[model samples]
Target: MQLKPALGAIVAVSMLAIVFWQQTHLDPKAPDAEFTTLSGEQIVLRELGGQPVLITFWATDCRACIEEIPDLIALHQQFAHKGLQIIAVAMPYDIPSRVKQLSEMRKLPYTVALDIEGVHARAFGDVSLTPSSFLIDRERNVVSRVTGRFNLADWRARIAAM
Candidate 1:
């Protein structure tokens, strides 16, 4: 009985440490992450110089990520002509085939890429959480980061301001 209590305490402490680490990982300015688009073409961050860019890291099996797709799609359509560029990068653990399939099924009106080697995640401070996102201004500076999901109204306002 005593051992069980001690183990539980240890787990709780470990969980706290993990949470702290994840918090510390937040707030990083996204680096010039390179992406290979589904069309086998490469897009470097520096190339998107004159547009507000949204780089979202997600996984096929992540419910929150999936839930945010429609909103992202709509937002892309609403803002693309106004210089908004949305890029969705699949998490390293997600199957490339599934990611492509989902992208097709949803008709994602944005660039979809597979981060099979985790380079994109590392470029954004080794983000391991699903639905993580970085919002960059026209000058290519990261202006916002969302770890789980974004509120639609708030997202639109931010993009509008960009």
Candidate 2:
């Protein structure tokens, strides 16, 4: 019986470590993944040089993903004019119709892409969690990789540095 508590503690600590490890998983170069926008426009990630780009992996069914929508929308509205490109990439398993419906319902000001083929996720380091964002610098270097909900203050700092 005592072993059960110790084992449980180990699992909890391991889970926390995994989260931090995933959060720090940054790529040397921003991979070029082509995204098809909801409007049917094709956007290439690598080609978007000289611009700070945020590629966010999200899913319609994820509560955290849903909660981050407003923050992302505001961020897009604020920095988009300053050459920031925010791309919300829906996870492969998320129902496409629901994703589209949510995108329309939220009135997302930024581009929303569906990674139905899992290519986008693979390109962005096999992102398997909702609300993972890769902050790519103007030079196309992935400066930061954030997993989980975004922090407004942290976002401002990243944007200011860009």
Weakest lDDT window of 10 consecutive positions for candidate 2: 18-27
The C-alpha RMSD of each candidate to the native structure, in angstroms, is: 2.9, 2.1
Q: Write the per-residue lDDT of candidate 2 for residues 43-156, one digit (tens) a residue.
A: 988788899998899998889989998888888888999999999999999888998899889888899998889998877776787788888899998888878887877987
Residue 74's lDDT in candidate 1: 84
lDDT of 1 by residue, 23-77 (tens): 5765544577789887787888888888899999999999999999988988898
Please report how far candidate 1 places residue 53 from its true position, in Å. 0.5
> Per-prediction TM-score, please?
0.85, 0.89
Model 2 residue runs over 4 Å out of place are: 1-11, 20-25
Taken over the whole model, the C-alpha lDDT of each candidate is 0.85, 0.86
